[model samples]
Target: MIPTDWIYGLIGGVMIGAAAAMFLLINGRIMGASGLLGGIIDGTGKANMKERLAFIAGLIGVPAIVYFTIGAPATNVSNNMLVLLVAGLAVGVGTRMANGCTSGHGVCGISRFSVRGIAATLIYLLAGGVTMLVLRHGLGVI
Candidate 1:
C-alpha cells in the first residue's frame, strides 16, 4: 500500500517545483537555499539583501510560527541531541561535497533539465535510502 507520507511528499515536490520555476522566471536566478542563505549571511546578495533576509527569515521562522500558531504535535526522539547534531553535521558535509542539497538538485536542477541535476538527484535518493536502511535496519540506530 502507498504510504500517506509519499502523497504528502509528491504534493510538496510539486509546490517546490512551482516555487523554483517562478523564482527563476521572475528573478533569473536559481532558487538554491544554501546559496541564498550564504549570500545573505555574507552580504553578497545585497542588491536584494532586504528581500533575501526576509526570505531567509521566513524559511527559518515558518516552522516555529506554524508550531506556535497551529500548535506543535509531540515528537519522540529515539536518538539523543548528540546524535542529532552529528547527523546534521554529516548532512552538511555531504551537501558541501555534492555542491548542493536535494532541493537544489532535485527541484532547481531538474526543472532546468540539467544532466548534473539528474545525476545528483539519483545519488541523493540512493544515498538517503541506503543511509536510512543502514541506520534503522542494519545498525539499529533508530
Candidate 2:
C-alpha cells in the first residue's frame, strides 16, 4: 500500500510544478521563491512590486491558511535554536551565491535544460549528502 505521506508529497510536487508552469507562462518569469523575496528586500524588484507581493502573499498565505484549516503535519526538527538559525543563514547565503534556490535551479532550470541549474543542483546534492553523512554518522550531531 502507498503511504499517506507519499501521497501527500506527490500532491505537493504536482502543485509546485503547476504553479511554476503557470508563473512562467503568465508572467514570463521564473518562480524562484528566494529570488522573488530577495529582489523585494534588496529593492531590485521595484518595477513589479505588486506582482511580487501578490506572489509572496500567495506563497505564504496558502500554506498558512491550509495549516489553520487542516492542521500542520508533524516533523522532528532540531530543538537547537542556534543550529536552526545557523542553518537558515547558511541556506540564504548559499542560495544567493548559487544565484537561485532549489525551486529555481532544480525545478525551473532543469525543466529548461539549463547547464548551470543542473550543475548547481548536483553540487548542492553532493554537499548535502556529505553534510548528512558527517553529521549523522561521523559526529552524531543529528
Provide the TM-score for each candidate, comma-separated. 0.75, 0.93
The candidate maximizing lDDT is: 2
- Backbone clash total for model 1 is 0
Error of 1 at 124 (Å): 1.8
Q: Where is model 2 more than 4 Å wrong at Cα?
A: none
Evaluate residue 28 in candidate 1 and report its C-alpha lDDT on the 0 to 100 scale: 75
The residue pairs that clash in candidate 2, if any, are none
Lowest-sum lDDT 10-residue window in model 1: 34-43
Error of 2 at 9 (Å): 1.8
Candidate 1: Cα lDDT at 102: 70
lDDT of 1 by residue, 45-137 (tens): 778887677767877798789898998657775458887998778876676667677768877888779999899989888988998899889
Tell me the lDDT of candidate 2: 0.91
Clashing pairs counted in every model: 0, 0
> Model 1 misses residue 15 by how many Å?
2.4
lDDT of 1 at 68: 86
C-alpha local distance difference test of each model: 0.78, 0.91
Model 1 CA deviation exceeding 4 Å by range: 1-7, 40-48, 72-79
